[model samples]
Target: MKIRSDILRIYQSLHTWVGISAGLLLFIGFFAGALTMFKQPLDHWVSPPAPVPAMLREQEINSLAQQALAQHPAARKGFIMHLGEHENTVATMSWTAGKPGRELDFSGKQWMANLDQEGKLQAKEELPSILAQMIDMLHRTGGIPGKIGDEYLGGYLMGVAGILYFLALVSGLILLLPTLAKDFFALRPGKNRKRFWLDAHNIIGITSLPYHIVISITVIVFAFHDQFYDSLAEVVYKNQAMFGAPPPAAAKPYAAKDMLPLTSIISKVKAEAGDSRISEIQFFGLESPRPMARVALVNPRYLVQGPEAGYLIVHPYTGVIINASMLPGKESTWSAIVGPFFSLHFGSYGGDMMRWVYFAFGLSGAFLFYSGNLLWLEKRRKVQRPNQPLPVQTLSTRLMAAGTVGVCLGTVAGVCFTLVAGKLFAAAAENINFVYLFVYYSVFLSALAWSYLLGAARASVDLLWLCVLAALAIPCSSVIMALQSPSSNNLTGPGIELVAIAMALTFIYAARKTGKRIRDETKDSVWSLQQIQ
Candidate 1:
């Protein structure tokens, strides 16, 4: 409570510059990251319904798998058996083939198979939707595109931002320490505009400090994990493998018929994983010497290895669990030590309720960044006196204002428009994933250009309206699609639509408030319409 004046000044400058440097990038990441909380629902919401195949009896599943494997050689590489019905499940079984790529890549062709009325296999090849993957990519990359070798350029850039984010958090906390106790709960709303904004920003930042700290650390780790591993290999392990070599291959290849029954595999997984519900059972290298199965299960009480579910790998023929390190309550010491980072960063441990809490925290974090930039711009404003010439705002302040409005609002509008496009073009587009990227960048760049040309004061109102319209299009498109085909709509569609409606209303309010600021409060600042004139 009694820091030297010079010390406070040093931290204030550090907090300002560091936060400004990283704020916009983090805004995009946080906004997109929030949306990823409901990725499964988003996948289902964007997917068009296909005719469900006749349900297979318990005995028929193995028959279907055998036929699929016999006819399609690629099925031997890997395939997933769907154990439950969902909107995104095109068939009871599916496998992807073609050029190999990363898990997030949408390049491969998907083949779906299910039993027909006569218990014969019906298989078809189609392209998978990229909506959810695209959103996740934005979250990971912070809207920065391109790659350096196997890694994303945006990822490394975000990792740097994450470092600055951590510094900003520390410096910001230091600046607040002197008056934090007295002013922590103080949110004075009056004619002094700067005080109000600072108070609001401080409240949100301090309240979510723990969440922010976790995100900042995890982001750096995820972005440069490859580098971390490489350094460990070079310095710590030297000539040895980090996790040890893979298991040795079997003497001979195994056929699909040699694999245990689907029911038996599920039972084994449940027994091993304990009170968990299985969603998918994926088999890999079935025809290779080392055949394996990965079972994905969900249990709220346990920490998950994947984004949505905990996983266990097993030997397909023997039904013996080969690796339970990633399973809940069965994790190895190393996994147990490392699991909380993933769980906290992903909100993967506590089920849907935790997802919603993370979602709220994500939005609040995004707003914190947005307000940081706004506060920076306001702090540098050149005030005008009555009957005097208008104060000339600095180029840096003008640019910051435009960049903040353009980048933040543009991301919001771009995602909303892309969501609408995914539904509208689901049946018509030959390459829907390409359509998604094209639509998003087209809108995003256009908005950025609009903000620069119009200036932040005027552009803010227009972009907010754009966000409103774009968000409104989501629910409206769903309604139109539902009217066209009654059975096509699922529960997820309405859930997404309701959120979009709420978002649209929020933007509408923002547009009005921004217009009021420009008209009444910001006459002397970069946000004043008179500055553009």
Candidate 2:
């Protein structure tokens, strides 16, 4: 309690600089992360409107499985009994071919069955989630992996950022502790710019402090999970079971007489796993003596199969439950703890409502960093000479101004454009990812260049309007397609597009406000676009 003023001052400086350093990256992370909460839905929306094969009945599942195995021996190697099918879903009797990362190559393993004209079984792979995957990748990589030689390099940097953020949290809380009671609710938005920003930053940061802390810790875990596990094992377990699990049965192969039926395996899973929604039963290790099946279930109301939380492993041949995550009162203590962390980070614990809540919080979190950067620039405003050109200002602040406005707005446009592109290039599902990369990076880099060349104030204003156009283009494209063929447009995708446009319009409004600020308010600042000229 007897901390020195010098130490406190040092902490204050540390907090400011650390926050400013990671601000834009965190903004990108949070913004994209918010969208990722609804990644599945977005994946579905932008996915092909064409229907796949209908559901397989209980009797049909067994017959289909047998046929799949006979026709495609790779199905015996490892495949899934897909429990559900979507319009854009795919069905493969056998996973005969796949390259590294288990991305099925499908070059040799492709097969076709009786086409009932209505698709008795799924015909093709569901459209890949190009937009969602891109956003998710950017969030995880912090826009660094591609730039760096190694993909994990970006994650390593983000992990370091997490460390800095952890320090900022501690120092910030220390700074606010003495006045926590007084300014806990204090927000005076008078003429004082710092006061307004300080109030907002503190309010948002404090209220969501726990969430932020969770995010920081989880980001580190995600980026360096292997390291964390290795360190944890080395420090605590000493090669022992740090996290307990059901003992695996002998992996010896069994004959058909000894093996239990798939139905029996599923029944056991349902009984043990409770009211969980089964997703797919993944069969593996067919070449081995004892094949196994990962009975994957989607545990709604909790983070379940997405992170492999609640799963059951059955002997593939015998269908005997070798291991189950849902053993009654047998859940490992460490697993229980880790389960919620993944759930919280992925926002899969709750339903649609929770996703929306997370989305709002994520956008707010992005703003927290954006506002923090603005505050930094505002504080450094006095260090520059009056009416000095932006090029001559502190390189840090100038770069920050241009990079922030450019990258963030550019990402907005990139996403909107990619949505339209995903639809336009649905037929070329395999190559659509390349198009997404081209469009996204092109828009993103273009925005940064525009900002650096035209100046942040003007570029920011222009990009906001550009975002409006990009977003509106989605619905407009959908409408045009619908006019050409009414059945093609289902309105769900366009409805999302409309929402995006509505969101983009807010940027339009903000652009107007920013323009007013440059012309009417800012006089001696780099943001004073007219004055700078």
Local accuracy of candidate 2 as per-residue lDDT tens digits, 311-354: 77777665567765443234456656676777777877666678
Error of 2 at 281 (Å): 1.9
In candidate 1, stretches whose alpha carbon ends up further than 4 angstroms from where it belongs are: 51-58, 103-107, 237-245, 251-257, 382-391, 490-493, 521-523
- Give TM-scores for every candidate, taking all chains together and pairing residue i with residue i: 0.93, 0.86
List of clashing residue pairs for candidate 1: none
lDDT of 1: 0.85
Once model 2 is optimally superposed onto the true structure by TM-score, how far is the C-alpha of residue 215 displaced, in angstroms? 1.0
Per-candidate total of colliding backbone pairs = 0, 6
User: What C-alpha lDDT do the candidate models reach, one value each?
Assistant: 0.85, 0.70
Best by lDDT: 1
- Predictions: Cα RMSD each: 2.8, 4.0
